[model samples]
Target: MTPYPRWTLRTEHTGYTVRLSPDGPWAELDAWGPHGAEHGPSALDWSHRTHFITPADAAPAEYLPYGIRPFTGAELIAAGPDGERGSWWEFDGAQETGTGLRLAFTDGLLGLRTVLCYETVPGTDIVLRWTEFTASRELRLERLDSAAVTVPVTAGARLTYLTGQWSQEFQRTQLHLTRGTFTMGSIQGVPGHAYAPWLAVQDTTGEDAPAYGVALEWSGNWHITAEAEPGGAVRVRAGRVPHEGAVRLAPGERLTTPRLACAFSADGLDGLSRVWHRYERRLSGERLHRPRKVLYNSWEATGFGVEAAGQLELARAAAGIGAELFVVDDGWFTGRADDTGGLGDWHPDPAAFPDGFDRFVADVRALGLDFGLWVEPEAVSPGSRLHTEHPDWVYRVDGRPARLVRHQLLLDLGRTDVQDFVIATLDRLLDTYAIDYLKWDMNRPPTERGRPSAGPADLDAEHVAGYLRVLDHLRAAHPGVTVEGCAGGGGRVEHATIARTDVVWPSDNTAPLDRLAIQHGFLHAHAPHVMSSWVTDAPGVFDPRPRSLAFRFVNAMCGVLGIGADLRAWTPAQRAEAAGWIARYKEVRDVVHLGEARLLGTPADPTCGVQYDADGRTVVAALSTGRLDGAPLVPGRPARLRLRALDPAARYRDTASGTTYSGAHLLHYGLPFAWSADHDADLVVLTRE
Candidate 1:
């Protein structure tokens, strides 16, 4: 009898089954499309399991740790002070949970323990895995990886992933799997925009072929690796980079690795993305269903020229276009005329605001808008009085000049003083005023990362932990305030930090045409509501492509919409058009933020667009970078846009046209072209009647 029966786990339309041998272990597993099964693994179908393993290797023999059995990645790995490394692991037992299963492994001699976890949701193909390590005695843990799992794949699978630089993030790369290790990561003190913490392996049949993807839920210093064996087996490992200090654990203490989420999709990359979207909603975005306020920021309008009178005027214009939150970004603090100085001093610039935030906050509130402010708590400008008084606060090595980016040095959040300082500053501001939101910005990566003042330590982990600590204290003290995370335009975007903040400033480049591609790439792993996109008057800083105001509004409306335009400079017609768009967006905001989304085609594709469908409601934003030329598009007519996720038997109505049609016809044919002009686009909102 099989020691471990087929433990089958199924989501809405996907299934994964695994079995174990008493002497060997739980090794063989399969991820396939939706199917039913009996209670036990033996009672179900194990007939096709032999197809994946080689014919010769399929025959069962005596259990042995040899190459012939197959090289599956270890679910757990640990070491003890007694030098007991990888030799012995006794399988204690297993149990099942509502979502998934748990297994136990122990090293008797070293008194080391490991608990392996696997979790799943009812409607997602993602299987979550993480491990916990504990010891009865003090153990010097040298290596602990969040994920090391071997997946069965077709003979020739292709690897697809994201990699790029600042201003140009999430460039997709598709490559054939080779018989070697392919690894990527960042130890740059934070998750750099150069490489995202996600990857995938897909069968090469076509775009619709079965595929799998993996993601690490960490914001600081992460790495991912794909190792393809010569025999067509592949093992992927991902987690926090272990380049420096060993995670030393004391007796009776425990350490938990980050969560590694792996998902399977028979419908290909698009399916994989939707699975992640579901998983993201399950984990983060608590207030996501809450109406996201249409905010107006003072950064682009006034920059370092921020003053009470100017911001009050901007707030009126913002309220003119139905902005709910009016934010005073940068230049409100002591001596902060520009990025050159006055960072750590978290006080109102007396010259700029004769009376602190009181009168200004009242005036903005009187305009029927919530107020927000920009802050960089983890940095201190060298020319400021804060640095002159507390020079030891910034990150520095002994006797070396602190490396400066944007002419400011990063404060060592790892220090107790720094942590307390941040908490106190935020408490003071929140306790003092009617501030409703915060724009937390980190403009530079860590330079001289070592905090010499602190003793031997992993500064990266400490900095992040301390940063979160500050945010936590603030949240506990003031639950009313919301936060938007920005690391010089989406640099620190990851599951960990994202889980804590209310939103992410995806990019500083607000150019509508360029954002179509950037926002397209963003939806692959993150939810649309968390990505805060702004409609701007400025050209795309990277591509500099000129576009229309309607084009800009529709692009930004794809996510948590914001208007960063210099509203004071807009003509009356533009303001009226903008007001119309804002009101229209408000009507469908629920569907866009809390909806199930899919990319009709990729961002890189010429005719790519985005679709959101929720509970029989659908919205399609069709984008045209150039004219949708050469396709069967009728000139001067609306482009034919299709809708998904409608009941087949039901009739649907286009709210704009008041015309009803069968769901089948809409899916088969589509709506007609309604383009304003070249490089402009359209949004269609439809629902079942």
Candidate 2:
């Protein structure tokens, strides 16, 4: 439209535009933001007198090879059989497909073709981008990133990403980049707890400014690197299967990178978060409409002491407390008395369930609760029969000793034989019993990741492919079963895993205060329906502050509520209180799960809460985190929280307190809260009247 070779892709609320440089054949991002963003002069125009860098280096390329982007990072890096590592590609053609657009480039010298693909999520402000590489001859690829995203900034950029160790996952971290590059990734087999495959970049100038976000839909090892180029532009490059060395692309073979979801928001990080949540809901498809049932998992309750009678008793108690699903966690399998043994053996332990596994499941189902089981299919105990029978199934260097974590060795999921065995194990279990839910767990990373039989293989990519294949099979073959993903808590929780599973365990540490902080950070990027939080009696691993059971239930209710406490130890009064909370959660879960979410305040504040608005109703789970003895910053000033996504003219009545207020008043003045030592949390529901 502007005399340049340009294309514009529009989603429901945003637009993304790419243009071929008028003087050259390379394509670059021209505009990205709210609709009509492409009308103005290009923000990425690099026409001013630039630094000593090459034109290709300074240009905001959509996807460039190593030779073109010599100084800065390149999205594609490959070597021919003759050991040449650079690619000189010229724009061959461009096409618009039914799903999205594609721009292709070809290097005649090397007989290689590169295609940059773009697709917008129909109902959300997200553009899915990736690249495909095909060579006439074999090429060894060192780095084939999903896409290279360039955000045009005025001066500097601020990066916000999630990072943490195992139990303390999803810790929101921020880094301001004036120059140079900042990188974070996972080298472990899975997308480990070290970092989530997501990044958000904002201009360092304003509080309420447009922000851009990118998330890689990869379950394997990956990296996201952001570089602040010399000309006030920030470029983010993300890819799958990092540090696995070169992947070989045979002649005429095509390699497609993982999809990198790119989004924009003029309403700052919070708005950017909602964009991701909507896209995820779209990714969930029809599954989003189904109710996320309140579940009781018998992990923290019974541990390795699982028995038929004890489980049935727990199921009875769970049903009484309004739980719709009951799950038997680890230690129910044959020879699995503790963490040391009995992995990779799917059969139930006769000692634990003397009658039969089916009888135990039937008894639990008789209590009006769906049945679920936990299994770590990718792990094998050294003493187990499966491991002894096939020692070669585990990952290890030919003559080297295998390292063990949690007393279990990693199975070579990359191998077809191993994948088949895993599929068979799961198929047998599901075929034999009435398993309405499955909690798939992976506890450790691979130690000696070597496949001697397959020369020059990308072991990481193979494993990832196998993992996804298995999940896809489960979805197609067992559509009725609900899958909950866990990897020693919150490990394999990228978009790839999230799309296949019904829910994800955010962390193993279910202590109320610690979990609140974790969930607070998690909600910044993920939707609440997939966040599976549990009410457990285990004390805080990080913070030892004793919170009431009400605090725990309220905190867990913010997501898919699950109870993991030993209900048999509870007094009748305690049980009655839990029943009330569970009943209350069921009534408002629709809004809580499918609504537009707003984080009122952070966990560091004296009072913090999450507000959900949907179906002409609002649900708020507010909590007081600070000490009770403290007075307000302004004495006698009650804590008030503002609500988001509300109709200003409508009148709403609180279901619990029977108080009515105009929506304008609720928005401007916020609802008031009374905090005390015993009553630290409140679940308030309001219906428009």
Candidate 3:
């Protein structure tokens, strides 16, 4: 390893090495497992580097673009006031910061300043990269990427990403990354659920280990691109999808792109994700000193026919089954029966609750559960009084027909009046009711994002800022309130939103089977603690998959547990079983919420599981995909489940069997649990001594 002009950033297990080269700069990696770093590459050569590419026709005195540098996808791009053709930047220098490094480059001719920064936490392999640009004079920027890294991988590497629609989010598929640009993005005001803001590049020539990933933190329009160059080099770029579709810079103006966090793992995709999870836990403080409360929502049980008496019956049932949080979902507000009407109206329906919401909330609280209500504050149905009164409150062009999705028009949250109305409505509700939670949902994406009032203002960026302000303001106003985010589903599950909300509703299709793939994809970039999964009834609103109550409860137990099933329709036996499951979840809820997760297999596999370990406690959940997959069918017999993140010298005992095993045996040899061909699931809990 070189001493000067070259540095290596390290965690206990991984290290990122960067060195200044004749061509520019290049980064090497050590992704070997936590205890092994000598097996990784020491340094990458400059001839294959992926740094900023300068203009092809730069002066001899200027920093010449690397001969092998890419033609496109540079981190900085700009045009001067006189319309310069190309940019030639000179490397100012690099500084070593405690957390990471900052490399400065400037285009003096155009008066643009660019800083490339890198950061890594002590216990995480995530090396966060971001770009900051400042203009000394008036200049226009065409492209300003947050992160652009070129890492050489084995030929025929496979790329995996998540994509889906409204009801279904976080679908997964893998394909060979050939020679071309594979871009997945959304210019739709919000980061649409069509594609997630993360990607993983795996060398298909070997196992899934030693893969690389990149993710952006912005909640607004964003994109992740993976390009396989002709010379077997794979480059990835991620950041905001340009400003207002394009950004214009004035003198003294500055812009910083969203921070792009990346990770490299030698232990497989699971290892890569664990690093991200730890980083998130550091971002969001420890889970509330306690387990996530068992929540029971009144959506599937009583959709739009909710009344005080009906809700009370459901609340009684939910509390009987040991639910700690009771949430009344949509349809309690004025003029709301379905998605067609009544969005902006936040107050309770006087006709549905004759005792006004006060008595209803009080009755629910009397059942020993914190109360929550659902609201879509960013949308307004045309048939609602809110839309009838303020016709111009919705986002639309001067003379264009307002586009409606889910029978709702997008609210021009960019406007001060619209923002004030939302804050006042929610503030009044929080003041009036004894509510503990609010399911903040935006059921549709922003369409016709043009604000008539502001004329040509960039509502895309302003709306996102407004949304963040409302959340922050509400929390500051009522610190006790908890908000669960839902944009149709997992549309808004980015770092920006996750940092502000308590939990996220991953998907509306709560069919136990379908959720496995969705939850698997989601946990790659997000920690499991905030993944709000529900155990809805079979033949769900979308999927017709059938699963046993035990299977369903255990499936939902993978994250924050919520019950949306119709408990009234269940038999006495089912109710008793549900009660038992809820109790078991509470016993080990902290493990699921805060423990490090190591998923054993891919989502396409028939036999897969996730193991969680923290302190001296360990919990492993094994799930079956119903089909045998040609393996030996051993009903009720669990295969050997391996474990990770345990103290090797410690001795562990199973609470249920009273059987003791050394940590070596439990981890290397494994433990046995049983699963059937019909989506059977079992949880193995062990304590160390």
- The C-alpha RMSD in Å for every predicted model, in order, reads 4.3, 1.6, 4.0
Taking all chains together, each candidate's TM-score versus the true structure is: 0.89, 0.98, 0.90
lDDT of 3 by residue, 130-176 (tens): 87788898776666678776656557568878888876788776778
| Alpha-carbon lDDT of model 3 | 0.76
Runs in model 1 deviating more than 4 A are 5-15, 21-87, 109-111, 121-125, 136-139, 243-245, 453-455, 628-638, 674-679
lDDT of each: 0.74, 0.89, 0.76
Name the regions of candidate 3 deviating beyond 4 angstroms.
Answer: 1-4, 24-43, 46-70, 82-85, 286-290, 453-456, 540-545, 628-638, 645-651, 661-669, 676-679
Instruction: Encode model 2's per-residue lDDT on 322-421: one tens digit a residue.
Output: 9999999999999899899999888999988999999999999988999999999999999999999999898888878778899999988889999999
- Residues 352-433, candidate 1, lDDT per residue (tens digit)? 8766678889999999999999998888899888899998888778877778899889888878888998888888988888
Prediction 1 global C-alpha lDDT: 0.74
Candidate that beats the other on TM-score, 1 or 3, i.e. the better one: 3
